[model samples]
Target chain A: MSIIIDQLNYTYSPGTAYEKQALKDISLVIEDGEFIGLIGHTGSGKSTLIQHLNGLVKATGGSVYYNGADIYDADYNLKELRTKVGLVFQYPEHQLFETTVLKDVQFGPKNLSLTPLEVDLRAYGALKQVGIPDDLIDASPFELSGGQKRRVAIAGVLAMEPEVLILDEPTAGLDPKGRDEILDQIAKIHDERHITVILVSHSMEDVAKYVGRIIVMDHGRAVFDGAPKKVFSHYKELEGIGLAAPQVTYAVNALRERGILVKTDATTVQEAKAAVLAVWKG
Target chain B: MIRDITIGQYYPADSVLHRLDPRVKLTGTLVYIVSLFLVKNLWGYLIAALALAAVIRASKVPFGYIVKGLKAVVILLLFTVCFNLFLTSGTPVFEWKFIRITKEGLYLAFSMAVRLTLLILGSSLMTFTTTPNELTDGMESLLSPLKKLHVPVHEVAMMMSIALRFIPILLEETDKIMKAQQARGADFESGGIIKRAKAMIPILIPLFISAFRRAGDLAMAMEARCYRGGAGRTKMKPLHYHGRDAGAWITMAMFVAVIVVSRRF
Candidate 1:
């Protein structure tokens, strides 16, 4: 395991009138090269729990260990830790302050104190990884479309060359096509790079298509953590907490409920289609 | 993170103050602020405070919420009281090395604190009863006469209304950005002043860009709707001055006169 969170707790505005316990005793281990999907409703502590992995949020109680070392140890350099576990915030295009997209992408690698030639090489490589065009590299990030700006933001983080990558609601506010494009890009990155990817999303379909393991949270606690098929099997419990399994899984379950033979584990439309075809042919 | 701001908090109520015309409420607030400054004596201060309390009770806003609003400025209030107490030289009630707390000074500090407290409470009363849209409409009507001075009164009011409308949206966006940065291991707390400030760059930069993008989109939308520079613009709901509004103005005039006369004592 590359990241291990043991009984992590987090509270916002800890001593003030606005104090809120956003996370409660969240414990999870993320192994290297695994794609994990984190899903929860608003204010469910999904964001709070993930932030502990990179040292952005210090645990109120318990500890987070990164590669066998406590991240909160006084001797650990946080900036270095951040570089090792890159975070790409939602709508990162907003953080693009450089005059050119290339310069903005170079920011993280430059923070690493790399040679100028190395910085440019890493920046170019990062931009390519996120599928940004060469001609657009020198153009201002502000001039890009909403979806393009999002890609540029992702590239900025990739330039840091972290061992693990975390993204929060990366597809939010995007049209269906835009959402699919970004998700496809991220999936490709995970497949090729073999870096541990933690994706926080509310959409079941996206998680079903991309992540291998699904972690479900409710009211600041991790309630379920398993493969998509195993997690979706607890349909009633998920529905009680205002969450639903992927549409195909729900449809398959409905068919089974109606006394029609179907596999309830079918998560994607393609899988459901294949299962139905097999039953008809039989 | 930005949602914690409590500015322009509106308390929903069905009281007479809530039913009153927003223009009347806006004018009453202006008159009330002027009266607070005019009063210099204990009796005048007490009367103003009493009037504010009456308004607060009539508005039916929770006393706890009003007190919470005051808590934000408690430090400033204390500084004002201390500055007046030790700096004003009069018949010394208590003295220390190079410092004297006088009877007049004590009275001044007490009155000053009461004045500021009542001033904030009174203004909050207006906000609590009046929605931002209504307040902006009232402001536009009130400033309409400034058109003779070539001032774009309607434009200013429209800008204020738009700004007010975006407060919640901006707050929500800020929350999203904060979560996004936090997920990436961008530590926001437990850093030195400079380190903390540098941490804000990731959040702030994204917020500003999004805000600008929103502004651009709003401008285009407005243009598509044929919105000009307030020229020949007609309102959907025109403000009507009624008998009750006139009565409110008269009552406010009397209230101001009472405070001014009480100051002469």
Candidate 2:
């Protein structure tokens, strides 16, 4: 299944003093099983754009297609579209209201009218996927630490077995260690399930390390959409919008500036390592 | 989609009413509401309507915008009109099978409808001109005399302002949580009343939790900065009455006088 957005436009509070055009005439396509990174500055329409994929937001103009079917059609089933395109919001732990971690995760599958046995199985599978401990399954989600609660929230969406998973700033407010753990687990989920993943983050390092494709949004327009290496290579343009490339991109550029030739397109540490080793062999 | 509310929304403008002191606007709104209740005749309503029109004009807020607020109060308006028309007893102006329309009843209903419409418009006008901060500041100063009765007036005002500030924040939070739950296949629409109320559980629980957490954090942050009671606290922008405020006060008094005089006839 694929998702396609064509010439989308969205304006907030039209005809009022607070009116703002959040998304411009933007278009993009998402293929199945592709791990994509969506990055933007605050209010750059990243949140608004992701909201469109699940029909949480309707575009004022243009159209959205899911699996080659127009999602805006009068007869389109939006509830099903929402389930198929699961969205894990920022600080999603705030949405966890169930008594137990297992119950919270099961909420989604149960909403699908699944049999009790299937609900429990999918919930268990999701909990395991997010690496929730067996002992904590019956524990109140509210009692868990911040990171644990966040994982349960993600499990809540994952239990639905969505075809596409979109996470908005999943690592926000988490420490570096927690951030790495969540992203790595998401990568594993994408690999194991072969489901499409859209990771929305403001952090350059987080997206560069995991996502194969990066879409850069600026002032309601997608400024760059390409592989991490190609997108990060325009570090100058990225820096102009209060964003910078990953550390390795800057380090490689710095190396080139200091009269040592290195592949400046390297966006991650491993790629920088390979480039430096190649230069060292010379 | 919850952004359609127009009541209690401030309209930014540099008109006479907006430039006047918020205390004047507050007092004007209170007196206007009281006068609305006091008036008993068509002449009184006409005077009140004129005053409202003048205030709206001076407020620089579009008349249509002020009228939009009446949408929420439409049912109440109709209820008031119907009760005064059919239930009121007097000389019959029109008669149908079981329906009786009396001359006095018709007059009462007309006056009642006008009174209600004016009440809503007059009140919303103040909100359109005065922002919440200015309002709280005005209320705090106005209620300062009540501090002698151990009312914790300053703290109450602070709490009130904070609550006002949290409305939009909590609304945005509600939107986020609702969408998060919806993404989990939670159906909020297409349900019976009981089912719909149950659907709200997910949104309400998280909203209350987050609101309390925010309150706790705010209390700590205030305490961290050595915030004590209101005794020694000074304002960043103190409320002061300008010439425009005095003029507004005189105009409000005159508006009340005219309505009160017209009520006597």
Candidate 3:
């Protein structure tokens, strides 16, 4: 279940007045069940990279292999590739169309050509996985709150039972509570299902909190790919490319500057606090 | 799929036609189209072609670019040609079963094909040179007299401009929604007519919702800024006629007169 990207390059509106190379030569291998964060500034090619993983957008050059199968092969089934690698776009709430949340969530499973009973079961299981309440299952998705509608939209993709789930800026525009709730639910789901989850976000903190591995994209190139601490260490370079490290990274650094000697690589506030406490006890 | 829609697309360039008053371009296009229909004989058509050639030369838009617009209208041209070739009854040039081609029918078909090609070429030139804002401003100014007859000319112009502006946004929305659905295993390409159309519902719904939401937001934003229609509105860049605009009107009149005289004499 590994995805191997080989020297991918993509140009938008190629050869036209508006031609732009959105993704440059980049290669990486993502192992199965790895929780990865794909973060970058807006228009940094993070979204484009994620889209290529599922074959939504074909790269202008290079190839993508999922589970030892070349996706760009002549006979490769792109439709089936999409099922195994589901992508939830930004502002997923706008994708909610069915009258009821249940029906909307079932849309993906139905498209998979599952039996009605199996579709309903998958939909229910997905909604449950997302922590959507039972009372809201039959409710009109449009009538729900913004956060609830977004959850239903996410559930739509989750019902497809994709081995790899990719979400693009899923917490964008949500309140902090809503953002944390969604991210917590995602982390819990990833823990339970062990599906490869790639969360694309602009916020470093959000990625730092959950993902074990973080890939930082700069102008269509993956400039850094490693554990959160390793990526966060190059905060200054990331800021040069229009991305700031999480606030906790700065605090940890500030403490070490003040001679407190806490670990500077603490990615989250809790990690920073624990590091500070450890230094104090010593 | 969205890229196929090339209508009303403006090609920006600095040229005599691009600088001309949009009102002049609009009226000239109308008069030019009228002249195409007014042409009755081969001589009239020759003069018509000459006038179009002159206009196109002055427009500074590339010849190949103008002809490219015909790609979308060729079907209509062929349809007109086919009907005229086989339907008009006259002295038969050739006959085979129910298929017939007559002397007059052949002439009519050829003439119609020329007229339509010229028509598309002429209007496309106008759109290519004039921006949508200028088009609406010209439309509103030209139709201002209708306000006395209870026509909401300003409102109509505003609506047209808004619709034009929303087209690109809606198209982008459609593309995004289509991709989102496709990622969920929605099959849009490999289906029959009905199945394909049914697949479109997922995309169409979100697009319409987003459109309505945008419209609502725009209306609210407009109202917040005290936009109450054209009751007492004044233009930030009010249009004025230059010496060249009058010159263009006279030139257009002369062109049409030539076509009319050729047809009459």
Q: Which portions of model 1 miss their true places by more than 4 Å?
A: A1-33, A40-85, A109-124, A161-164, A173-178, A191-194, A217-224, A234-247, A250-262, A269-282, B9-19, B46-50, B53-121, B141-154, B171-207, B220-258
lDDT of 3 by residue, A78-104 (tens): 999999998999999998888899999
lDDT of 2 by residue, B1-265 (tens): 6555567778888898888888888888999999999898777777888878887987788777677778878899999999999999989989999999999999889988988888888888988888888988888889989988989988898887787667768878988898999999999887799999999988898999999999999999999999997988888999888987788888878887888788679
Q: List the residue pairs that clash in candidate 3.
A: none
Instruction: State candidate 1's TM-score.
Output: 0.72
Best by DockQ: 2
User: Which of the two candidates, 1 or 2, achieves a greater DockQ against the reference?
Assistant: 2
Residue-level lDDT tens digits of model 2 in A1-282: 799999999999776667899999999999999999999999999999999999999899999999999999999999999989999998999999988899989999999999999999999999999999999999999999999999999999999999999999999999999999999999999999999999999988898999999999999999999999889989999999989899889899999999999878888788899999999998
Residues A53-82 of candidate 1: C-alpha lDDT, one tens digit per residue: 777677888899999899999998776788
Q: What docking grade applies to model 1? A: incorrect
Per-model TM-score of chain A alone? Answer: 0.98, 0.99, 0.98
TM-score of 3: 0.90
Candidate 2: CAPRI quality band: medium
Which residues of candidate 2, in runs, are more than 4 Å off?
A: B62-113
Candidate 3: list runs displaced more than 4 Å. Answer: B12-17, B41-82, B94-96, B101-103, B242-254, B261-265
